[model samples]
Target: MTRTQAPRSSPSRTSPSHLLPTEEPLALLRPDGTPVEGSPLVMPADDVLVELYRRMVVGRRFDTQATALTRQGRLAVYPSSRGQEACEIAPVLALRPDDWLFPTYRDSVALVSRGIDPAQTLTLLQGGWHLGYDPYEHRVGPQCTPLATNTLHAVGFAHAARLKGEDTAALVLLGDGATSEGDTHEALNFAGVWQAPVVFLVQNNGYAISVPLDKQTAAPTLAHKGIGYGVPSVLVDGNDAAAVYAVVRDALRTGGPTLIEALTYRIEAHTNADDATRYRTSDEVAAWLARDPVDRLSAYLTARGLLDERTKDDVAREAETFAAAVRAALNVDVEPDPADLFEHVYATMPAHLRAQAEFLREESA
Candidate 1:
């Protein structure tokens, strides 16, 4: 049977009635690590949950390390996805090998979870040239800095793939703030009209920089925005890795446009340069800290006897090793040749650029 049709074990645990999504966000696990009522249609195995937990640990480490690197004058800047690791890693795990992921600037964790080397994934953030790694090699689009621009690119790619009759889908991720951009609306509209095999996952981290959701839009919910475009929508607890994975996997099986709005929080500032404390309160941060995605999964696994002290130690050791490797890779300074900047702009260098390149060459000589 296809993965979407795979049978799942029956719900073995009962949870509070309020835990499940009605018109609310779907939450599969409570904050205390208990399973919610109405279990997912296609539950993943214990091993899969273990792996997801491992990735979440690594993703958290990556964010912390990157933020430290920025503070230490190593990286140019960083947009840390500290509190949203579940949203960062789960959807990538749900996709097929041939599927494409279009990530936002803050989605370094997602790209890393998708098999890109941590160093390569952060290259753009390091102020390096040319998106760090080849997009075609990894089937990941550029780590886009411009808001909502990559949404259109993802839709176009999916439409082209459908035209070519390829069994492929594209997943586009954007911040809640980007939902307000015109490009986002246009992309969703096109995807719905064409029935493109693309999914849009909005990580609603409660703010657009310092602007809270209340200030960003008057829409009842971001998912509602998709309904107007003729696309189905889901509201998932962004902190529940299992639920996010299940929803994304099911959406992929539909072979059409869908939108998933994950209600999450951005634990860190918008980036290393921004001071979140100036706008948000410490109590607010403390409240979300209680609902941390990594801690939630670890608690659930431990309660189920799936995670023990040894396993926790192993995951922590692995995360430390990964962080060390990323630090070492990023510490090596790269001295780019100034003249090489003029080489890749076009197949044949234009006369104006040729003159500029000559000027740089003579100056350096």
Candidate 2:
């Protein structure tokens, strides 16, 4: 079945009656790039909109460049967030400097938007050491590879900050597939129980690594999963940057956990290693391309006379420059130091590891 068709909810699971009244995905922009009637979106200033557009452009270029790099063997692998550029740029742009972002492996675009250097952000995928950049410096957590693990960490950090009386909120990004993990359930439950200041953005990009949403859950919607934990939930058009930013901003102000399920589609295969044509039809992808987030936003801006030919040229140049930098950085080869593997594992190495470290050191010498 196509994504537009509603999935059957399992009879075994049910949501509470007090759930928030948001069954349909909230969308600010129409397919034609006009605002929906009575949309809650108070359009931001022209400058803000322009910046959002720039980031989305840069993000798409980044994804494209990374995917190419992976194919060229410059990087290990890349999970391209090609169609979800709006989801990547908007939420991070809505955040305050002090706020923290916890992202999944697919969220390298989000991390880059959070002011992380592109090279450092892609380091993990490059098979480099550690979480490339300092999380404290950017107020961003490491790009978590394990599904749903970072959700728990985000909640714990938010709860700890609340206990310490710090005005901080954590925004955790997850995929629709992650909702199936036990870690997601536990984290949402605790976040609600503690009233932790956190927002969970579940990008429902159709398939979950070949497993479609129908097989992932039978809940009314992924957002409804939050209501079971006593947390409010909302559905948003993941492709609409304005709607996403507004929804996430409101969630942060609500002073507790909120779940937002963004209905979007992944335009690319799961990763460089996976073949999407095997599981999905090209027709489905073509349909989503018509509603591409970057194009929609660009159309809106152009219609408003905010983005002219010169501005478009400038943004394109900027994106190209950014992509060139990424290519140049990834082209440089750095031989991994054999002894460095022993570093950062512990404050003090265990005896056996110490012996192993020494043996490797002697062998390398």
Candidate 3:
């Protein structure tokens, strides 16, 4: 009694708790707008921070504007990246000039951050032209719409770069739902075996169309899937640009294939044609809104006295000017040629395709 009977250890210490597995990659700013210790951010450096903020704002504005255009029947179906701007922007910024990017359908915001002309994106969306740029010139591959197929392309690119002794890396974007596909698994396996310099970025936006995450897999986390493939994996806050950038940079420096599972939410419908309310609840939407990336960054900047009312107004005005310019450019009515498809099939058209092209020409005439 006098020795205060040795504190009994809880037997629960040996028991594992069934909690969702997560990897909290380093975050520069805390939720309350405070800087974390040893963060890579230099907030006082106004130029870089302001430029990064501008890119994020412009990307978001462009996405919102495009959604409106789709609804107004100006463009065909458009993927809305409403709550995903920061996730797209961060990795694009972290890339070197010669590095390659494999963008998915919803990664237009990524192209914007990587210096792609907004008009070109619009042209593709409006069906006025093919991608409208030489992929080699931009080092950005054509957008892949066949879900997880681009993962293999990224792996191949990395393997080629390694063979050529090139100091470059490949970054491939995919949706969380894409992980269920065989291609995604194969890509990871090959990359890991070869130690390819590539990064597999999975934007976990909680839903693949109408199917929720729980139904897709019994695995604790998408990032953990990489473990079996022998690729190092990490999870990060996709909504936070700083966090995303940090993780991408780390992956790039590590010199091997890495899988990043970015935990984010799809605030808008999957695309303009989708009706999220049919499956998800309003309460879920409201909760995500509370964690809005732009709002979070704005609050942080304001709290630090870096952003004020006048600065916000200036940002708004700049965004509006950009949107107006994009709108005017997109309004130009230019229909692409149907025959152009046959033109690019080969350097010298195959005999059968050539005959087919002539047949089409004669039929049209």
- Find the candidate with the highest TM-score and give its number: 2
Q: Name the weakest run of 10 consecutive residues (lDDT summed) in model 1.
A: 13-22
The lDDT of each candidate is 0.89, 0.90, 0.81
Candidate 3 local lDDT, 1-365, one digit each (tens): 45878876854532222112254544676655566787543333445455567778888999988888887777887888888877888888878787899999899888877877887866567665467656887899888888999999999999999999998899999998899999999999999889899999999999998899999999878888877777878777787777777778778877789899988888889887788999999999888887777777777778878788998888888889988887887777776666886976588889999888899889879
Clashing residue pairs for model 1: none
Ranking by TM-score: 2, 1, 3
Please tell me which model should have the higher lDDT, number 2 or number 3: 2
lDDT of 1 by residue, 1-365 (tens): 68789687774733433222348788788776788888654666788889999999988998899999999888899999999998999999999989999999999999999889988898888887777888898899998899999999999999999999999999999999999899999999999889999999999999999999989899788887876777888888999998888899888878998888999999989998899999999999999999998889999999989999998999899999999999999999888999879877899999999999999999999
Compared with the true structure, the alpha-carbon lDDT of candidate 1 equals 0.89
Model 2 residue 76 CA deviation (Å) reads 0.7
Tell me the spans in candidate 1 whose CA falls farther than 4 Å from its real position.
1-21
Off by over 4 Å in 2: 1-18
Cα-lDDT of candidate 2: 0.90
Q: After superposition, how far is residue 365 of candidate 3 from its true place, in Å?
A: 7.2
